[model samples]
Target: MSSVRSFVNLIRPSIFVHCEPIEDPCGPSATMADLN
Candidate 1:
């Protein structure tokens, strides 16, 4: 499960970049907080 999470984390940055124009709470920063 951790490996999957890590894999998702790797790809999330690109998605985050594309989604950055929106004021969404599911950004990388929020994800990191959730991960911790």
Candidate 2:
């Protein structure tokens, strides 16, 4: 179960990283071009 959680988090970060601009309205930092 712990391994599964770690795997989920690993994949999760990548998903969040790729979200970039689309998630911007939720936070000001989201508009930062450097995030892309």
Candidate 3:
């Protein structure tokens, strides 16, 4: 899932903004709501 990789990349930076990596390993759904 290339999209998943991209998603991870995009969200990786946000890990600090939200400070919730494990709880929301999926990252901020808001960023990829359309894909989900």
* Alpha-carbon shift of residue 15 in model 2 (angstroms): 9.3
Candidate 1: clashing pairs of residues: none
Global lDDT of each candidate = 0.54, 0.54, 0.57
TM-score of each: 0.33, 0.33, 0.33
How many Å off is the CA of 29 in candidate 1? 33
- List the lowest-lDDT window of 10 residues for candidate 3: 13-22
The number of clashing residue pairs in model 3 is 0
Question: By the lDDT metric, which is better: model 1 or model 3?
Answer: 3
lDDT of 1 by residue, 1-36 (tens): 555556767988454222224365675666456655
Judged by lDDT, which candidate is best?
Answer: 3
**All predictions: root-mean-square deviation over Cα?**
11.7, 8.4, 10.4
